[model samples]
Target: MRVSGGSTGGTPSGGDGRDRSDPQAFKRGRKVGQTVRGRLLAPGPQGLFWVNLAGHKLLAALDHEPSLGRELVFRIERLEPELLLRDITPPPSAVDDPALLLAALADARSRFEAVLHRGPPLFAETGAAGPNAPLAPLAARKRLFDWLASTPEAAGLYGRLRELLRLARAFLPVQAGRPVYLPWAFPGLDASEGLVTRSGRTFTLRLFGRLAEAGRVSGIFSLSMNRASYRLSLERPEAGEGLVAALTSVRLGHRELAPVCVHLGPLAPAESGGLFAPLIAGAARPFTGLRLRV
Candidate 1:
């Protein structure tokens, strides 16, 4: 079960007849036998997968159903006919500790929040002007990406942010063959535009995030053109419930929209189950879920 390509060509080289060392080569163009790293964003129609390859979205055929958000290194198996990638990422070690993975995720989230705070103001006040305006979130994201490029220590967090941005981009509605840009009202917040759906004449934009308050807090904000709803789950439920009560009578403007709902409960369990789950189930199986006709 091998993925075929043009040929096992020689190593990529420069005009000087020496191997090129440009770190951004993958972004320029892919070559057969060249290795590239990408994160699986989501599944597409016909068993195809949407992969984020060096800031570019590409549709790829896989041999198995890869878990979403999984990062893998792939060798460019074929460039013509259809882009095929052979997973070359090494499997999780038998001694891999799930605790360490969880800790890393926590650290990444904290670092991401810190970066967001120091970079720019995420949300605009009612009458804010200049830099803190409604478009600030878009600018802030770009600045954060630039900062991540220069700060090597935040590499893990960078991937997570990139993944979130990719997810947000995926939800953008296309019009006239171009995506319609929806400005992020909360400007600099570290929330992903989770979903967008249209039914009848209403369009809804959903945002999701977990922030550190009195411990970690998870929230979902669903906004329509005329109304908004919020669902927040906090570590300290009583405090959040009190806050929601205080804002219950607050009006956004002259119009009274739908009532906002808040839910308080325990944090959802981690998706990765047992410590040895990946080891037992095999993390990188040959993708056989999607079949392509040549």
Candidate 2:
């Protein structure tokens, strides 16, 4: 059976499947109160430039998972375009009806809007002070969506979303608005780097792979940086399966083949209880605590 993220289980053979376990895979999962890092590597310069484009949400994700510190870095490389194409599965209906393609585009746009309109963590209904808040996870997610939608360059983003959906459909089913994750299905990157902390102890992580990227020199570079920074954060020993699921759920897109490298270091956890302190202080207040229903 296909795994939840959409690939057949047990890792892909011949470089066409996911790496079920990292080359450095250990028997243990990360522990609470430990620091973690994750990095993604894209084949070209584009990946590197854009890796932290989602910094707003990334920081929030790290905050939610305290085990993850805020330090992330992206190292990128250049590669050939054809090699990148070799990573993704062919779309079952890419050449179907033009109308259908347009409809899919429309669907993708709408989903993007929902994510955009949600705004930032400070505006979330379940903000840090809210009963359902986990250090404002919802709000942070909102900011990420907004940032992507609000970029000044419309044509570029259009191409990006189109490519992302096409790739998403190839590897997994796209529910009009659900997040999808595409592993190294795209060919471009050779490695992703990050820091791993177990029981408060830290270790550096380097992951190699074949990832896809846009053929354009600019696009390749942008993607490289983005992937490197993004994936490296996952290296933390405390990173859990849920966060992994959420990340892999992001839409994957087409790009040129290129080399991608991620560098993560100087990783550190936020001050202890830094995120929780606000909630604690709010609770200590006489009226604010009373007004908020536990």
Candidate 3:
């Protein structure tokens, strides 16, 4: 049974089962564990304990299915905390006033609706498409699970989730599954070009300029990748304060903080040739620091 999206909740079957007890399996699993550990250690700020939960669940998923490494497929899902709270016990602090919490959630939802419709203010200037662009609005819903591993914010959120899973491993008999790393938070970047300094905060944007010159893309969306941390930050100039505020207010689920795949769907295959030069040059550029703090 080919389960979609790396849902590591099952046993390996058929010929794959022969390798379950192999020492190599344990080694691979250990590597995955280490990745989760590193993610938690590098969440960037203190006072932010909530970010490790997603990593914990990913590690847990890997423990359950060692076969994940063999498969080319990966899946990631993001869940709003309130949508999840009903399914799991809330932390003590959150347990006292479910009604108040719900009310806050409603207000947040209203605010989000207002802002999202207005579109991100900063991004507004850029005129980039939203999570539901190119494709029909309904089609975007199916791709929600794709956003988890794409952006630094989502990554930070995932790091917090993984930490939670590590904590629970001590008491819960949770199985470690295969590692399925997805890049949901990153949107539209299959690759890039230009120059970046190692661990620096700013990198030059070149490839997109070329693409724009050629009229391949509608316009350029600048992307910067930080080598040391593997963080990808996109310039969403249209994103307004409201979206930023929502980002600040957002909470991640311990099991899934960010969707790994934020599928904007495909561009015309013919247009892909137009992106190649930029993609190659961008990826080849040296690492530099990122300035995503806007």
lDDT of 2 at 290: 44
Q: Regarding lDDT, does 2 or 3 come out ahead?
A: 2
* Top lDDT prediction, candidate number: 1
Q: What is the TM-score of each candidate against the true structure?
A: 0.35, 0.19, 0.20
Off by over 4 Å in 1: 1-35, 38-103, 111-139, 149-156, 160-215, 224-226, 235-294
TM-score rank order: 1, 3, 2
Candidate 2 lDDT, 1-294, residue by residue in tens? 000111123322223333222211211342211222232221112111111111111111111111112223211111122101011111224324333433454454555434433533323332112222121133344455355445423223333344534433332222222222211222222121111222222222222222222111111111331232233322232422232232222121332223232322222343222211222223221232345446
Tens digits of lDDT, candidate 1, 163-248: 33332232223421211222233332243223445555444443333323323344444444576676655555555554355333
Candidate 3 residue 287 C-alpha distance from true site, Å: 31
lDDT of 3 by residue, 150-246 (tens): 3333333344333322222232222222111121222332222222122244322222211111222222222233211111122332332222222
lDDT at position 65, candidate 3: 22
Segments of candidate 3 deviating more than 4 angstroms: 1-69, 73-75, 79-195, 199-205, 210-294
